[model samples]
Target: MNAPDASDDPTPLALPRVPRLRVACAMQSDTGCVRQHNEDAVGCMIPRDDDPLALAGALAVVADGMGGHAAGEVASHIALRSMLHVYYASAGPPPQALAAALVAANDAICERAGADPACKGMGTTCSVVAIVDDRAYVAHVGDSRIYLLRGTAFRQLTQDDSVVARMVRDGLLTEAEARRHPERHVLVRVLGTKEFRPAVAPRGMPLQHGDLLVLCTDGITDQIDDATLASVVRSHAPVDACTKLVELAREAGGADNATVAICSLQAEPLAAQPDPSIRTTRETRAH
Candidate 1:
């Protein structure tokens, strides 16, 4: 005779919780055959299972340093270290946090360069990819790049901030001509510069199971063509993909410091325990 209580409903308790997305990542960096010192830096920040902040889902970056001597190495190391530190310490969404992190890194590098006469003109190209849930956010400066590979198709996600890239975009030069251009390696925008402005992706890229994300310095791109790069990625596992890519670049004369980070996304399945109290019946079907 009494009205049923809404709080007593059992339907809400029967609903299942959503599973978290899982990502497998691998990174490889080499000084290459020509460079006396490795000026490239690669790193990733994978959140622990019990992390409280949760904002730092997964972040990966690759930085290619310039300005000869040990200055290049120091610039790149500073870029990566500062970016990671600021990213984890800051609050808000992944995209905003990543952008702020890059800015902080640029400022840190600039301050360091200005403080030391030997590193005055030092700069570095940086490309970062941050994934949260089923989406990926990107932040980049200079010629380093972030690429996405899904199934049989591959695409570059970030535009190069290099003179040759700008020329090609303006129709002043063809892709082939740009590749062979004398100033192809000359960067128009890079970190550690007074006028540095990071290019952040307007929106996160929707990720699907089996999606592959590649973050690398121009060293890899300089040695490997897009088609060949795609083939090598598709043919190898995540770890092997990184190793093979670096190896391929080195085999191609290794003109610069080669560095690569590969991340593969997969959907995690929820775990359900069997209830011994539930009675079940098995019935065989006829063929």
Candidate 2:
């Protein structure tokens, strides 16, 4: 036998790298039974290949407007549009970008409210989610909410900036009592105000495969409880879940416009390969 050669030594092959998670989103909005016109707005923007400032992920936003007639709709629309635009247009990390976008949105809404008499004093509740890589950054104002469903457990990621919520936090009222309180709809912090500040998630939440993010105006939560909401999301696909939730809200006597956006993170699919066992044949025959 030949002597063993150093160059022929066996080496282990490196393991394949795992692919990044891709997000699937679904959204719906409805004018509830009581509301004559929908004052809620929902928007989402996924990064494109050609965009240099892209976060390599997606952004979802929900805004609930608080003014009568078309004013409320305009405020919510402006806030949603401005926030999404600023987030994609600015170049920075997710948290900073989200903050800047919210501030810019607030200024834009305020300016519009000041300029137009019909929209004066118009304001809206906003909840935004910036999903980048394996993390999610959340920012919000007023009563709209963001919830996270990881595995079987569900958690509220944002707090309501309403009087009832404040009372509950201060121990003056129980959660149930606050929910049924007469002033539950009074918001303390809302966009379009001269002085407004948003509460941003201090640290990003680590996202996992099968993680479900629920963004919605209070209209949905007002009708369906958290447990029921989570159950619906887990039982159906993203689009179907949104549709079911909105329908449920309407069935529960939706007193306000309902809007919901669902986003699910999933592992990228493996590439497909051609099957050698199957062969194709082309024949030319005289007619």
Q: Which is the leading candidate under lDDT?
A: 2
| Residue range 1-287, candidate 2, lDDT tens digits | 99977678765344455546787789999999998899999998877646764553699999999888989999999999988888887787777778888899899988988889998889999999988877899989989999999889999998899999999999999988987899999999999888777567667888888899999999999999999999999999999999999999999998889999999998765354223344568798999
TM accuracy, model 1? 0.89
Question: For candidate 2, what is the total of clashing residue pairs?
Answer: 0
- Alpha-carbon runs more than 4 Å astray in model 2: 1-16, 269-287
Model 1 Cα displacement at 79 (Å)?
0.7
TM-score per candidate, chains pooled? 0.89, 0.87
Give the alpha carbon lDDT tens digit for every residue of 81-168 in model 1.
9888888888877877888888898898899889999998999988898888888998888898888999999999999999999999
**Residue 182 displacement (Å), model 2:** 0.4
Q: What is the lDDT of every predicted structure here? A: 0.87, 0.88
Instruction: Score candidate 2 by lDDT.
Output: 0.88
Off by over 4 Å in 1: 1-8, 13-19, 272-287
